[model samples]
Target: MSTAPQGTTGGKTGPARETFSSRKLFIISAIGSAVGLGNIWRFPYVAYENGGGAFLIPYLAALLSAGIPLLFLDYAVGHKFRGSAPLAYRRLNRGAEVLGWWQVLVCCVIAIYYAVIIGWAAMYTWFSVTKAWGDDAEAFFFGEYLQAPEEPALGFDFVPGVVYPLLAVWILTIVIMVAGVRKGISRANVIFMPMLLVMFLVLVATSLTLPGAMDGLNAFFTPDWEALAHPGVWAAAYGHIFFSLSVAFGIMITYSSYLKRKTDLTGSGMVVAFSNSGFEILAGIGVFAAIGFMAFTAGSTVEDTAVAGIGLAFIAFPTLVSQAPLGSLIGVLFFGSLVFAGLTSLISILEVIVAAVQDKLGWARVKASLAVSVPVALISLVLLPTTTGLFVLDISDAFVNQFGILAGALVAVVVLAWVLRKLPMLSGHLNRISSVKMRTTWMVLVAGVVPVVLAYILVNEIIAKVSEPYAGYPAWMLNTFGWGMSIGLVVLAVLLTLIPWGSGSKDKHDPEYEAIRAAEDKEEAR
Candidate 1:
């Protein structure tokens, strides 16, 4: 068959061919994009930190109101356009392709650091096998693996740690992705996603059997109504929802671009969101159950039993694994499973960079992937300076994870919700294939309530942080700097909105834009 319709085409193609069914492909792609590190690590932490059970209320609320509706909007953009972000936006709004380019830039930056984290996971897997972590295991795990070390500390220098491994794994990721979506990404997910679920189930089963597992589960599920009263908790819930759902990052746009137009928008979004949230809930159960087990056996509190940082997954999880029947065998499987999860995510991250380079530069996928891989490797090297590398990774992650994603999401929501008047189209598409229509309540939620809530989060978070005192700087001036830094992403997004993209002669006839009538015409012809 012909190569997939990737880049934008010049001539009219009668509403680009739909080789795949949207309902089937979109579900897979959406799940692939959503089920990443956020569900595994970030969601549990935010949920646990934000009053555990209390966080659930706002989280589910956002899921129903903001997350699902917004996700449907993203899926509609991608599936409707049958192109990646750059071309997708070019179809929607000629001027807003700046948003497209911005999305690309953000993905590129995040991918640079994401590779290092995956490499760290790889390094941890090796360490697990060899049991080579010695007395300095804690430092090695954190300094070397968790945080990239800098300058004359253990595992110092970028090349030995960050640069080479990142390059190697990224190249590997590119190879998987370059194999094309169906055989490469989809096939891998079909295999790896099941494995992740199985491993997770086994872990959960074992944890529940542990002495205090039920207690920990209760702590997790037990209601803490007062916790919901805290603004910070609500903010954390919203942030986690965005992060876990993989909204705002352009991944959904990119991945969904591969989807066929007839996909069940509402149902697929629900599946993706619910499945990912289920995994997070499962992971939480396993994490806290293990925490309870370790605490009871070791005579420690849950806080004391719990280990944070990179070592937790490697050293701590392995400790639990070692105690299981066939400990070494299970340990290998656990870390091995983590490697697959990490790799799957790593490739998706790399694909963002690859897709962006191809769109902007018009290079072939393989060439673009290779070009991006080199710079990413060099950047990863920055994390090799003792534990300083690790620290930088965290800083980079923090910026992109919340600020970058939230900002991009804000733009996306504004574009789709306001600029495009996309909700009605989304509803119409879903109403066609779906048995049940998404309630009108969601339209109000997406356009009015969600944006206001996101804006509140954006402002309150920055202001709250800015008001805090810090050392070694003039407090007032430094506070101003803090405020600026916090709102930096929002400012960057606003700046992009001011710019516009060059439109093609075909702009007015964009099959993906105001061409629903034309789409139907093409369908009738087919």
Candidate 2:
């Protein structure tokens, strides 16, 4: 195993990895990655379904035990190794190189579908004006807007409505990613994140003024406490926290690799974790408030109007916009926030793929970005823009989140904690650089509690899928798009690892390699 020293250029072997321009830039960029559609679109709905207010108990619990700790683990590995996921893992244990590639490939898969969702948001941002979704928001979104097919299958028939916006999304993402980390991602986040928060706050304020806003707030916070006892609710909380925090998909690891050597790893993780959760709570208030308004207008209850994921974003929100005071302005603010959130997340996802390629193949940043982005763009334009694209996206998102990311995180924890026995050393590294030192409890959560909980979630998901087709989709659909895609990722990961690690001037000769090796030896001796 080899390691690259902090701030050293790989020279002939790899392009020099760039550090973030400042600590503030790093934290902002990281928060941009963590606070995405998951918070605004997914969290509210997951909370509503799980226990409304009661879900917060398990959600925060998962955050403390699993989310923040795993984030710290990612930070320690990348900051210590000063490389991408594959490089970091390879340096840790040559045999575990495949785990790194697995996460990278998972990001690649996520990028394609994620871009499509962003494209949808992009289109909705424009459609917000004049209430283009018309009177029947659900029908307009599903039928007139998407023209979703009667059945799901791979088809190339492009929907111009979807394609045009999707094209714009790819172009925007490419420009930012090609610009390099500090100038592109960090700068973009600085502008996008604050603006997103302001617009969302305004939306929440307006919703509070609407009739029945209290009802919506009540439904959102009023938890079904009994639901907390259900294992499924706990699983959902962990799953939501995992996806919402954006860990185990190579994004955090790659971003941490760009941090300066003196950066505070644990403090950064805590900021990102808490910032992400705080935003979700805000989104919940805004979302449910709006939903309550919708129910009031329709002479119904909050439960009747409540939705999640794409439905909440496109259908329910658009409907509320049409009926709200200053309908057009409110609509713009709502959809615009989605675009900002989605763009930041999309850039982070693409960077994970770009970083992995640059490290493995020694490609320049622009070249690596293009190499990964082109294929993903083609997929989004060709497959995801079709009328049936949403269906494909739905199944793909479910499978990837459940099997791809959760499985990857589970493996990473096992390797670092059990196989390599590096949890203590990793914690020590965090304490050294961070103002907020990690206690033994963090180690217990990362090495013991987190892994067990993650395993339970994975096993439960597998059993549910095996017992019946997911969401009542056809067996072949689940088998092909769901199971097939998850298996394909593993195959791709193994194949990627088989490629020879390229040659370079600083490949195996960096001083950091010896330093890390010495640390590991000392730990093992203890």
Candidate 3:
């Protein structure tokens, strides 16, 4: 159907949906979405903590057997159905529309907290010049900078420093989202992705020249070959790859929905997947190298200094900046990379929600962008810049990521593959025009292997989180932000699915899709 030539259309009610001007732009944009802060700040720690060099084996296996296959699955559904996540799933099977809304609500929770991190990175890029976190990096980060109080108690006391930067970040995000597909997303990818690669390359080179750099390198690469036998290690590999690639949620599906009918989806999936992993490897090198310098200064080991997420970005790297030669340069490049990588991923996450709203309400791109994003920005502003913001971010991230993304993904594959039985049709759509074919092998991976990995990861997460209060927060905080937030998304998703789609929804009976289906049907009959 994808390969069929164009013909007359009959069902569209509004202007044609936007498309990527070229496949090159689509690939760049997809890679931009995939390569995010986790690549720079989180992957190195995951690799080191998992199995050092031996982690690559499981990571590669997970990428091939799960990540890429699931990516292809997302591409197939979005391209074939020609709609946003809810719309696409609705088109696939009416009962499945709830899954789409589930993914969108997940993005909503993610977007609210995610922007604050990006804002932090943007500010730190400048603080690098002044060495603002003087003396004790930890004290400054927690005390003067974040102003986070000792307890996890509730408060709306906004820190002016964080509020200003966060406001700037939201404004920038809204401007890009309002610009529409080609003008907004594709162009940002072209500008930001290249800049990210080059800046990160320089950061890596500079980190390698730091004193004790070889020690960090050795620690990072010294395969604790024994670690490979652990199922937990392999599970970590599979779990991180899902988050790293930005799959299972709605990001990839919404992005692919904008492609031209005959796009080379599977081939593009391969490029995006490998490129994302490649960036992760580079990040491990640079981060560990910097960690080595920190260890050298402290007369400790790289293992002592190595950390991930907020601690790695704000605390560890700041200490490195104060001590190492060319430290200021390292801080600038590293935080700058975070800013670029973070913006790209945040843009993609928000698009999943905005596009879903657009499809349901049938609004113009600008109206939809403002309607959805303004409320999102307001929520983020009100909730996340306060003194207790970090606690909320941490607890919410633990719950939402595990239940919303991991559990939600598990549900999607099971329902689509086992219940509705849609993989065969989606596979056919991929094989029709994709340079890489999806036949029995792709089917087995998506329908059989992918769900099992997701389910294993989900169950383990549930057990661990339920068994203990995450990050040692009080019961009230965990119950409100973590459990309550995840459950609320599910309930809202069901309610959203019940509402009728608006008249302006272009794909209610998509003419482009039907025309191609009819042409392919005629061809198949012949």
RMSD vs true structure, all candidates: 4.8, 3.1, 2.6
Per-residue CA lDDT of candidate 1, range 218-315, in tens?
76676778888888787777777876776766777777666554556667677888987887888788777876776776676776666544545666
Worst 10 residues of 3 by lDDT: 1-10
Higher-TM-score candidate among 1 and 2?
2
Candidate 3 stretches greater than 4 Å from native: 1-13, 520-526
lDDT of each candidate versus the true structure = 0.62, 0.84, 0.89
lDDT of candidate 3 at residue 496, scale 0 to 100: 96
TM of each candidate vs. truth: 0.82, 0.94, 0.97
Superposition-based RMSD of candidate 1 using all C-alpha atoms, in angstroms: 4.8
Error of 2 at 405 (Å): 0.5
Error of 1 at 442 (Å): 2.4
Per-residue lDDT of 460 in model 2: 90
Q: Model 1, which residues run further than 4 Å from truth?
A: 1-25, 134-137, 143-156, 159-165, 307-311, 318-330, 359-363, 381-387, 464-517, 521-526
Query: Candidate 1 or 3, higher TM-score?
Result: 3
Cα deviation at 9, candidate 1, in Å, is: 7.7
**Tens-digit lDDT track for model 2 on 254-291?**
89988877788887788889999999999999888889
Regions of model 2 farther than 4 Å from truth: 1-14, 505-526
Candidate whose TM-score is highest: 3
What TM-score quantifies how close candidate 1 is to the native fold?
0.82
Writing each residue's lDDT as its tens digit, candidate 3 over 334-382 gives 9999999999999999999989988887777898999999999999999
Distance from true position, residue 482, model 1, in Å?
Answer: 10
